[model samples]
Target: MNRAVHAVRRHAVMAVGVLVLLYLFLPVAVVVAFSFNDAAGRFNFSWQGFTLDAWRHPCRVPGMCESVSTSLQVGAIATVAATILGTLLAFALARHQFRGRASTSLLVFLPMATPEVVMGASLLTLFVNVGVATGFATIVIAHILFTVSFVVVTVKARLAGFDSRLEEAAMDLYADEWQTFRRITLPLAAPGILSGALLAFALSFDDFIITNFNSGTTITFPMFVWGAAQRGVPPEVNVVGAAMFILALGCVGGAEVWRRVRAARR
Candidate 1:
């Protein structure tokens, strides 16, 4: 009886987990499906039939490609800037004793806790008062401001689990600070740093609220999608969405495979 009850509980947990995953991924599945739809009109709603036209001619929609390019540029810039700054901040916070450290940590996390609407509005007001023009530069700056908090938070979590004794052992072997860091500290922290960077890029690319406020005349992909929604969104838009999803999935799969390979070798 106990064995039967245990099996039923395990099956129930698995069923719930599967349901939750399906709930999350059902929309993604639909997006991928619609990318191949032969839309009867500007609206890519109902599936008429499957066609690879959109995949073949993703740039067939004029401004769509340009907007995607802008998003990529902004995401890259923000990811680099945020990752560097956040990694440094994470190290300082985790490894040092300094004045106002508590306050500084609080400030670092404030952006994460604060609502995007509030942050966006505040940023806009600051820009207006400072007479900074709102455009691509402003968008990148805004993204960095928000994304840094996430990067720092992520890297800090990694640092918390780090074995400082590894650095000490390296030092005992007469390795210099930079050498110990280069050979030991960095390699372990690299996964966290990479994860933070990927997260920053995703946030920057997907951001619409903050970008919209700071974009002015510049259009990113999310902004383009928002504007297109007023009109009928193009099937090519779905193509872009599907392509991004596939690319992200590929990166994640590649990383996991690499991790498993490294683990097996160890």
Candidate 2:
């Protein structure tokens, strides 16, 4: 009787895990499926039939391509700026000691800890007080502010496990500070930096609340999707969503393969 009960519990646990996974990924699956949907009107709620028109002419909807371009540009700028600044800050926090370090560390979490709506409103107010127009520049600044915190946290986690003795060994071999850092430090930190950059870009691209608050005339991809949703979302929107999902999946797969190959080599 105990053996039978244990078997039932194991099966029940497995069933629950499967159900939770399905619940999480069901929306993503639906989005990918509907990318091929041939909807006659603006609404893509039901599948009329399977077609590749959305894929072939993803830019059929006016202004979507432009919005996508804007989003990419903003994401790129924010990622670059945040990565550089955050990596430097991470190094400082991880490697050095200074007054106010504790306070700085806590302050770094301010962006992440604060609610998005509050941050957006604060940024808007700051821009207004500074007499800065809320447009592309403001949007980029706001993204950088929030994304830097995330990058700092990620790179710090990676650096925390790093071996400083490796740098000492390099120095013992007569390598200068710059050479040791370039060869030993930066290379080791590359994975974390790349991860942070990718994360920052994804956040900037998908962000709507902050962007909406800061972007006066600039329309990003998320904003465009929001506006379109009011008029019944277009099928092409699903196409973009599907493509981004595939790209992200590919990145993760490539990273895993690289990790395996490196482990084998080691």
Tens-place lDDT digits, model 1, residues 1-266: 99999999889988999999999999999999999999988888798998999999999898999999999999999999999999999999988999999999999989988988999999999999999999999999999999999999899999989999999999999999999999999999998999999999999999999888999999999999999999888789999999999999998899899999999999
The segments of candidate 2 whose C-alpha lies over 4 angstroms from its true place after superposition are: none
lDDT of each: 0.94, 0.95
Tens-digit lDDT string for candidate 2 (84-139): 99999999999999999999999998889899999999999998999989999999
Error of 1 at 93 (Å): 0.4
Evaluated at residue 151, the lDDT of candidate 2 is: 98
On the 0 to 100 scale, the lDDT of residue 22 in model 2 is: 97
Count of steric clashes across candidates, in order: 0, 0
lDDT of 1 at 166: 95
Number of residue pairs clashing in candidate 1, backbone atoms closer than 3 angstroms, sequence gap of 3 or more or interchain? 0
TM of each candidate vs. truth: 0.95, 0.95
Local lDDT at 121 for model 2: 97
